[model samples]
Target: MQKQRKLVILGDSAFAEVAYECFTHDSDYEVVGFSVESAHLKRDELFGLPVVPFEDLEKHFQPGEVDFYAALVYSQLNRLRTRLYQEAKSRGYRAASYVSTRAFVWHNVQLGEHCFIFEDNTVQPFVRIGDNVVLWSGNHIGHHSTVEDHCFVASHAVISGFCTVGRSSFLGVNVALANNISIGADNWIGPGLTISADTEPGQLFKGESPAASKVSTKRFFRLKED
Candidate 1:
């Protein structure tokens, strides 16, 4: 810890706002404001913190003077936060990471720089996590489980408490992995998939959906142009 630094959260969602609360409660960084790309500005305030445009935020808080956290949850375009990570680095603001004091990180576990691991994560013994990783709430990472660089693990995903998560992979919410399974690099595991074997590199596995039943127009509401 060099100086008590200023901070700017890069999103306005609950996760970002809550992280602000978490950081302030445990650290000395004062959160200056929230920021986002111009197109998706929500309200002007987040948890009583002022909101600002991402491009112009540097004017108010110099990049070197303050640090930033992406704090954006993964959704349709999971790569969005990755892009923001690069953007922040290019602009000279060091990215900050927050590992919750409540997490069960074992002695042999390793976490890289800029990893924001939140509450209730059970990172077991010998588990290794790479740089730029984000582990959301209440996940179970089993012993000897290794998550590579730049991966995102959604809330409640069960990484069997030996499993190896590959680099740049995205594990959807509630994903279940069997013990000793190794997922390859650049793969995407969709929500609720039960993976029991090693997957090839660049593979994607999604849970099967049940067949949809045909319905008449009366089953759904329709709005007509006025």
Candidate 2:
């Protein structure tokens, strides 16, 4: 049997815990510890492992011995995760990526480091997923699509064929993109919105919430008075 690679996750939030569960059970990596910035180090232990300070991480574990995964969500439009990923690389630590066992990625897919692709994701042929990306459950990346670096795509998003999602974008759940659509950098596409045309950089798209009916539920349904 092959030995599992040692890994350290950088963060202690919900996403970090989820990453721990996925990497521990599904991947060929063993999570040994976690690290956070010194100012934000709220706890000393997590999941029975030590949580060390990022400033002093090298004193605890050598970069050559352990790989790192920045398990952060799309905070600051993914700039936080991108910064830490680049920092870890600058410190000579290899960034780790996780593709769930149940995901169907084509043989020719080009996936970059520090990415976390959850279960039920269908990545078709000729797809290119760049670094520090998070594709949540049940997303569809059609053939010839490109999701650029530092992007976070929530569950059930559909990127059709020949689409290009630009860097640092946050795609909300159930968002769908038409074929050949090109989304510019730093976009925030809200849930259930469909993008048919190309988008400009730093655009924000959200659907307006529907207003409630004026009539009461009892009157509308013809219920008897109490």
lDDT of each: 0.78, 0.89
lDDT of 1 by residue, 1-226 (tens): 3338788999888878787887888666788888988899877887787888888877777878889988876543245677787798899989988888888899888888778887899999889999778898889999989998778998899998488988778888888899999988766777777788887666656556311123211122231211
Candidate 2, superposed: residue stretches over 4 Å from native:
1-3, 209-226
The residue-by-residue lDDT of candidate 2 on 1-226, one tens digit each, is: 1337999999999999999999998988999999999999999999999999998999988989999999999887787898899999999999999999899999999999889999999999999999889999999999999999999999999999999999888899999999999998877787888888898766767665322234433343343442
Give the per-residue Cα lDDT of candidate 2 at 95: 96
**Index of the highest-TM-score prediction:** 2
Runs in model 1 lying further than 4 Å from the true structure? 1-3, 208-226
Using all chains and alpha carbons, the TM-scores for the candidates as numbered come to 0.81, 0.91
- Candidate 2 has which clashing residue pairs, if any? none
